[model samples]
Structure formats: structure tokens, C-alpha cells
Target: MNKYGRQSGPRYSASTNSAKAPATQQCQKCLEFGHYTYECKAERVYKARPTRTQQLKKPLKRVEVEVPEEFLPKREGLAAKILKDKEAERKKNKDKKKKRSRRRYSTACTHMQAELRYFIAVVVQQWKQQEQQEQQRIFTQLLFRILALSLRLSFSFAFALLLEVVVRIPFSLLLEISVALSLVQKQEQKCEQR
Candidate 1:
């Protein structure tokens, strides 16, 4: 590793034995030892240049552009009138919104009163309807009770009449036995006459 650009053999060299010898660093590629990657010649060998045909054949595209007013004639009176009318309309709309909010504030008491009246009306209507319905339910229950009592009384009366008819039937049977014995004695006297 001297300034003559030649490397020494792998064995320890007598030239490097002297401590005054300059230290040598190694290159990874081509196995040369002069420089590192920042000064690599092999990297500069592959740098590409664009061809003339690639530069000449490129296409052009349209771009949108806005022209200033100074580049054209300006409308003076008509544009001013239009701007004024637009401003007036905006002011009118703003006033209308302010008036609406003011009216809302002014009538807040009346609105509350109306809401209270509506709530009371609804509550009273519901209460009245509930009372009517309850009255109807109670009337229906009373009617059912009266009908049930009449039915029970009629059934009991029918049972009592049936019992009375059963009791009278025994006396009728005794009358029938006495009449049948007299008829049989009359028939025997007629037979003896014959």
C-alpha cells in the first residue's frame, strides 16, 4: 500500500512494520483501495441523458384563464344600480328577520296564555270523557246486577211451583183408587144377573 497504486501481498509486509507508514483503507468494489463510494467512478458510468425525440414529441394542453376588467370595457351605471338594488334587498330581508324576532318577543305573554288555555282545555276534556265513561260503566254494572237478581227470583218461583204440583199429585192418586174400587163392584153385579 504505497503511493505507486499497487497493493502488497496478504503476508505481513516489512514496509508496514514501520509505525511511520500511512494507514490504507479498502474499496468494496473492483478491489481497489484508493477511494470510498463518494468518489466511485462506476456510479457515474450509468447516469442516463434524455433523448431529443422524447423532448420534441411532448403534447400541449389547454389551461383556463380569467381576464381582468381593465382588459375589457366596463359597465358603469347599470352595475351600480344592480349593486344598489341587491344591497336594498339584503337590508329589507335583515329588517324582516329582526321584526319577526321582535314580534316573537312582544307576543310571548299571549303565546303562553294560549298554551295554558289549550293545556287546560285538553285536561278538562279528558276528565269529562273519563267521568262519562265511568258513569256508563257503573250504570252497566247496575243493570247487569238487576237483570241477574230478576233471573234468580224467577228461577226460585218456578222451583216452588213445581214443588206444589208434586205435593197435590198424592191426593189426586187417593181419589183415583176409591173410584176404581166402586167401578169394579158394579161390574161384578152385572155379571151375576147375566
Candidate 2:
């Protein structure tokens, strides 16, 4: 009996008789039309299960086999050719490094030259400013010296004029005293003769 408690037999429907053409039958076990499920030819393939012998079988292990030197492929001059190629690559890398270094050196030189020019220009400007300050200092000192000399000359001339006035006053008083004495003497002699 099947799982549904039905006998394992062919089932027919009313539609099978009404159809003029014969209907194709399919087997549930093998999924093929034309035969019933119990009469399927692929029953052994679908119902067969693995035995303990098959389950216990181990997988195959790989074995290494040595090849003879005579059977190996030949590479006669390949090592020399590889050496030459490596040398060429090394030379190319060295040339590239040299070019890069040359470019860097030229750029650094130009940068240094520009910095030197700028430094010189700044120094020159500072020197000119310092020279101008020195000249101004010298001119100021000369002007002060001339002004001091003129003041000294004016003070000396005023002092000389004051000394001449003081000396003339004393001399004039002495002359007046001498003239009055002479007049008094002449009056005394005339009184005695009388």
C-alpha cells in the first residue's frame, strides 16, 4: 500500500474517457510518463541506499612520483639570458635615479641663488638707511657748534662795552677835581697881595 492507504494500482478519471486522444500517464517514482509508479524501470536507482561498506571507505591520498633527469625539459642558455635582462633593468633604474638627482640639484641651486639675491638686496637697503642716519647726525652736530660759537661772540662783545663805560666815568671825576683846585689857589694869592 502507498502512504495514503491506497492500493498501488492505476487511477482512471472521467476526463480520460471523454477525450478522443489517449492520455499520457506519468510514474511518481521515476517521473516518466507512459508507465505506472509500481511498474517504473528506475525503481532500483530511486530505492537503493548506501551500505556500511560504502560509508566506511576512505578517500584516496596523492602519491609523489619522481621524474628522471633525461625526461626533464632542457633550458640551456636561459640562465644567461635572465642575467642579461636583470643587468639591463638595473642600468635603466640607475639612469633614472641619476636624472632625478640632476633635476633636484638644479632646482636647489636656482632656489639658493634667488635667496642670495634677496638677502643682498635687504642688506643694501639697510646699509643705505644707516648711512642716511649718520649723515643726519653729523649735520645736526655741525649746526649746534655754529650756534654755540655765535652766542659766545655776542656775550664777549657786550662784556667789552660795559668795561669801557666804567673806566671813562672814573677818569672824568679826577679831571674835574684838578680844575677846581687850580681856581682856589689863584684866589688866595690875590687876597695876600691886597
Candidate 3:
């Protein structure tokens, strides 16, 4: 069975196989058949033949012809004059280019300077703001530390005072009681002697 689940055999129709076909392959250029147009020798020879324009472009041997005196211009320094005019024109163009470039460069430089100034101002402002914020943070931390220390000191002092009162009050009362008992014993001994 094939992929579509049908029995596989010859798939072409009989009519297609029975159709008339060419007896020989013909070249499109020469129409002479064993090869295609690209391989035809006659087409290559025809392409290699030079056209009329190429034949005319071949250089002719030089032959000088004398110009009549009446047809020639009377100016003796025409070539020097042409050279001077060309040099002046070139200088003018060079000067104009230099001036234009200078103008553009100056404008660009001024704009860049202004931009740099604005950027520096912005950066300085940001730095100052950050510094102020840092100072405030440090101040707040110091203030908190000072308040905590004071609270701790006050608590420690109160605890020490309380501890002293708790210990000293009982000790003072015990000393007074012992002193009073010794004085009463001495008086009793005196009365017996009498």
C-alpha cells in the first residue's frame, strides 16, 4: 500500500504517453539540433563580429592640416589668459568654501559650547542636590544617635539610683536596730549592779 492507502502502479495516462513528440532537439539560434542555442558555433562567431560603431572608433594615422591665417584669432596670449582665468576661478571657489566651512564650524562650536554649559549646570545642580540630601541624612542619623544615647544614659542613671536606694535603706535600718539593742543591754547591767 502507498502512503494514501492505494496500491501503487504506473500513474501516467495512456494518452500522454501516446502523444506526438519532436524527432530531434532543435537549437533556438541555428535550429540545427544536436545541442542548445548557447553551444551553437555560428552564434559565437556572429557575436564576435565587431559592429559599425566599433569599426569607426579605430584611431586614424595623424595628418596635419594648415589653418588659413584669416580664420585664426589674432590673440597672441589666449592660452595664458585662459590659465589665469581658471586659476582665479579656482581661488574664488576655494575662498568661498573656506568661508562657508568657517561659518558652519563656528556656529556648531557655539552650539556645542552652550549645550556643554547647560549640561554642566544640570550636573552641578544634581550634585548639589545629592550632597544636600546626604548632609540631611547624616544630620538626622547624628540626631537620632544623640537622642538614643541620652535616653540610655538617663535610663542607666535612674536604674543606678533605684539600686542604691534598695540596698542602702535596709542596711541603715539594721545598723540602727543593733545600736539600740546594745544600749538597752548596758542599762540592764547598770541596774543590777546598783
TM-score of each: 0.20, 0.28, 0.29
Give one digit per residue, the lDDT tens place, for model 3 in 1-194.
Answer: 68989766545476664444354867777666666554467753243657788778975678999999999998769898999999999999999998997677567646644553443344344444654656544433433332232222223332332333233223544454345434445544553353
| Residues 1-194 of candidate 2: C-alpha lDDT, one tens digit per residue | 79989866446465653434214877777767766665566853466756778756854576989999999887668898999999999999999998997677567646644553443344344444654656444433432332232222233332333233223233543454245334434543553353
lDDT of 1 by residue, 94-182 (tens): 99998997677447635534543443344344444654656544433432333232222233332332233233233543354345334
Q: For candidate 3, what is the lDDT?
A: 0.51
Best by TM-score: 3
Off by over 4 Å in 2: 1-76, 131-194
